[model samples]
Target: MSVFADLHRGDEPLLLPNAWDHASATALAAQGFRAIGTTSLGVAAAAGLADGASATRDETLRLALALGSQPYLLSVDAEDGYSEDPDEVAEFARELACVGAVGINLEDRLGSVALHAAKIAAVKSAAPDLFVNARTDTCWLGDGDGDGDGEETTARADAYQRAGADGVFVPGLTDPADIAALVERLHAPLNILYTPTGPTVPHLADLGVRRVSLGSLLYRRALGAALEAAAEIRAGRAPHGATPSYDEVDALSRRGDLTHSDGP
Candidate 1:
């Protein structure tokens, strides 16, 4: 079994924190996280691109390459595989595998279901070692999980699994019953985005969810904090909360260089 497969069989669900850059990833790894994920929203926002719109392909690859050599597993959020062509997506997955990324999240986003399935199959065909986390936006896009019409979450998940996806991700799914049903039915790992209103990690683990992704929630919160702090400074007020020192921040963001030795 792969690392992801082993994680699913563990007693607790893998609480994955999505990182926006090398600094965030390294900081999380330093804090004892075994695996780190790249957030599409953070990458897009930082590059003045839009998330879920298939932009920032190169930016995502670059970020993956930067995090690849780090001493932790990397899972990238490749929005729709950056193309509708399954072969292109598969080739991209192969490249990511070459860079040492162990997993990737590919979203449907209410697009062609068949196309998504094809992408899943292609990635599996190209890089059997890479964990393909197929994402369905049924809850986030149109109708909720309870609604009858539109892309049904269960259907998409089932199809993805049959198409060779290693896992299925459903964001905006908060109901424990719905989560449990998906987890029970899907042979592959079931990953849910951690929502503030949804069940906690322990509760999700009990419900049989294999993974819990922080998604863009952390990134958005970080941005919110920065904006608030800047506003306070502009207003001649001291910034609230404890901020890391410049050196600490630098260290958190550093990527180990092989050309130089730190010895005397």
Candidate 2:
């Protein structure tokens, strides 16, 4: 198994923080996060495009190529693989692997289960070493009740695993009982999206969740903080919080010999 895949086998669940840009990714890596994932929403909104509509394919690929040279394990969130065709999805996965990404997240927004399974299979067939985390939006785009009964979710997860998925992700699922039940049923690693109102990280680990993803939470929080700080400055109040100095922020741009000589 690859190093990124091995992270899920440990005793503690891997806390994967999603990054939108180079600065966010390297800052998280500086804090010792071994694995970093790209948030589709972050990339889309940053590029002035809508997410989950497959509008950020080029942006996702560009970000992957940029972060590929970094020291951390990178996972690209290719929403629906940018194509409904399984072959195209598989080729996209291969390209990501070639660009140094060890993992790719493919989400099925409550689409046909068979189609999603085929996509997963094609991805594995194309890049056997790439860790495929098959995501199901049954709960996310479901009836909005937060009740993730194992019926549709389990069936999709089963199909994904049989299709050779390295892991299964069910975002917007906050029920501990439901999460535990799904974890017990699925053979592959279970990844749950971290929500402040949902079960805590340790609680999810106790329930057998192998991975917990922040899933755009950090990106949204960063934006919120920036807006709040700007308001505070406008009110003539001192802004609080740990802000990186100019030099510290500049240091993150130093990628070996590729250094920026321009000043702020």
Candidate 3:
């Protein structure tokens, strides 16, 4: 198992933060985060493309290559693997693994369970070591209120696990009972998206969540902070929050005193 996979075995849940670019990732790594994940919305929005529309495939790969060399584990969020064809998705996973990504996240987006399972199987066959976090949007895009029971979610998760998924993610699920139930049912590690109004990190750890992802939340908040700062300056007021100095931002590129780790 990879280091990233071992992170899920600890006493507490792995609180994974998602980054959009090199600077964001480096800043997060500077805070001693063992692993970082890419957000599909952040990547697509940065390139002015639509998220979950199968676009930004090249952009995702390019970003992965750039961040793969950093001294921390990197996971790329490939939206639907950029294609419905299992072969194409498998090839994409292979390239990501070749570029040093230890994990890959593939979402179903409420699509066919069989199709997503096939994609997971193909990815596993092509890159067996790549950690595949199979995501189901049943609670997210399906019933907007996050009210869907665990029947469909469990069925899909079961299929994905059978197809060799390292973990299963159910975003937008907030109910504690539902979360605890899923945790008990799934054999693979259960990953949940961290929601501000939902369970806190410690509470999630108590609920048996192996991994907690701040999916696209950090990216969106960064954009919000930038805009708010600009607005405050325009209004002739000083900005709040911790702002890095120019030298500090520039130092992210200069890797001179830093020892690079060979990531899994």
- Which candidate leads in lDDT? 2
lDDT of 3 by residue, 108-147 (tens): 9888999999999999999999999999988998766764
| Cα shift from native, residue 33, model 1 (Å) | 1.2
* Segments in model 3 whose C-alpha atoms lie over 4 Å from true places: 253-264
Per-prediction TM-score: 0.93, 0.97, 0.95
Error of 2 at 113 (Å): 0.8
CA lDDT, every prediction? 0.87, 0.93, 0.92
Clash count, predicted structure 3:
0
**In model 3, where is the ten-residue run with the lowest total lDDT?**
255-264
Better of 1 and 3 by lDDT: 3
lDDT of 2 by residue, 1-264 (tens): 789999999999999999998888999999999999999999999999999999899999999998987899999999999999999999999999999999999999889999999999999999999999999998998887776556999999999999999999999899999999999999999999999999999999999999999999999999999999999999999999879888888887676746687678
Residues 144-209, model 1: lDDT tens digits: 553223238788888888999988888888887777777777788888889887799899999999
Please rank every candidate by TM-score, starting with the best: 2, 3, 1
Error of 1 at 45 (Å): 0.7
What stretches of model 2 exceed 4 Å from their correct place?
none
